[model samples]
Target: MKDEKFNILLADDDPDDRMFFQDALDELSIQATLSEVTNGSDLMKFLENNLNKLPDVLFLDLNMPSKSGMECLSEIKKHEKLSQIPVLIYSTSANPEVVEILYNMGALYYIRKEGDFSCLKAVIGKALFLCRNTRLIQPERPDFLILVDDIRPKLPL
Candidate 1:
């Protein structure tokens, strides 16, 4: 079978962060097709429009206009077809409550966006690598890949 190009849905209000992520992905040599949304509403619209091409991974920003990241996470997880696709919360805020709430709500990972462009590259590289490998589990990665508990909260529909 042909190796499918990984589709990544990146939702962020900041234009700079969006562009930066795209550039960083290229620099990291992670093969992916990225789709972007500025807010939760846009994200929902995008998903509704492209149901056939749902993203393999979702990179979400917590604070966004129209709707919030946490709200979006809740909605995405509630969907039947979309729930299986891993959703990673990538935000600037490292708020413990936000992290806990997202984790509790079934987010695959909660990543705090930080550092220079190089740092972003490293995080993205690791995320993609871990995501591509399912059988091989390891410690000290990001929150999303490290959680192996299958009995966790199922997306509420």
Candidate 2:
């Protein structure tokens, strides 16, 4: 089946990371129109300026300068105009505390930046597929970041 094209946005401070992310998207099966910003402030500005052009998903890095991802997430959730955009925390840190914080804050997913390009391709593809089908709905802790092959549902007996 032919897949639909999706608009995706990434906000990260690292130049290399942005380039790598774009390259990863290039390898995906689905067509994605990706745009980027370098910091939390730019992300917000872009969203505000393009109120009617919000992306299908937003990949937000947590450690950006000017403003942190947490700050951006808070701002986005508080604003009625921007709250529906699905936010995925894209950061290097996989600290339990940080993950819990973001998960509780309504982030749909959290991905620790993998160094391998193949892994990046797989993760991004999976994220896109999942978001496209589910509207990037927030998953519970156990199922949030697990691949489809690896998830074991905790079904009630």
Candidate 3:
């Protein structure tokens, strides 16, 4: 794992969000390869096609065309082959109810997307570090949300 590049899949409909995410990852020190899909349908297809080489983590957006992130998440969780992959909810909505629902549904983390690049970089770096170093697929309820302002102090740099 140390020598291998982390594989990340981003499923987002918004072009700007996708670009922002890529930029954040670029600024991080970790070596990673990112694959992007513009919509949910394409995301699923990409996953299915790459079963032998599935991504280490998936950063999924809440709202997408063809299928919502919730729908995709449900399907991913239900599938035996796909259930082990860690999913991080990367969305603008920080609604508690929705976060709880996603957490219960088996998402590893919920990150509320902020416009600040540094915040985005911090949260993404934290998520990647956790996924790579720990066996914790899903954290306890209180630790589920990955807010930028709240993350820096909690995790090691």
Candidate 4:
């Protein structure tokens, strides 16, 4: 699509992280329409309600109260209508085993939340690009995770 505002959905419980995310997007000056949900349950509810008008991408936090991102990811992938929305797992943890599981479960990318705003913006930008280029279909093994220290295409099994 030419000259379109990217539709983005973010599900994170941390107020600070949510604010930082907004700030980063503003700083990047990305043309995007953003939506925020504080928990996984609400996130799923939003998706169910907006099935006909799903966001272009979802930035999911792996940690949250009630329903976890892992649970939501499973639900989303199983739902035919929601499965096409590319999901980026945004979180603070950098567990390699967890990352591998999420990647195998069908998340397009797993990104460790960056502490620096500049880095956050860069990572967000890179993620958006990937979402644009690889919606629905899972990325190859070499393009699965983005850690604070390094962005890895391959996760050790």
- Among these predictions, the greatest lDDT belongs to 3
Clashing pairs in 4: 142-153
| Model 2: per-residue Cα lDDT over 44-119, one tens digit each | 9999999998988899999999999999999999999899999988888888888888888888998878787766
lDDT tens digits, residue span 56-109, model 1: 888999899999988888888899987777888898877677676677788776
The number of the candidate with the highest TM-score is 3
3 or 4: which has the higher lDDT? 3
Please, what are the lDDT tens digits per residue for candidate 3 over residues 18-93?
Answer: 9999998998888999999988899889989998999989999999999999999999999888988899999999
How far residue 7's Cα lies from its native spot in candidate 4, in Å, is: 0.6
- Model 1 is weakest, by summed lDDT over 10 consecutive residues, at 148-157
Better-scoring candidate (lDDT), 1 or 4: 4
Model 4, span 41-83: residue lDDT tens? 9999999999999998899999999999999999999999999
- TM-score of candidate 2 against the unseen true structure: 0.90
Model 1 bad stretches (over 4 Å): 1-3, 135-157
TM-score of every candidate: 0.83, 0.90, 0.94, 0.89
Total clashing residue pairs per candidate? Answer: 2, 0, 0, 1
lDDT of 3: 0.90
**Model 3 ranges off by over 4 Å:** 1-3, 153-157
- What's the lDDT for all of these models? 0.74, 0.83, 0.90, 0.84
* 49: Cα error in model 2, Å: 0.3
**Is candidate 2 or 4 superior in TM-score?**
2
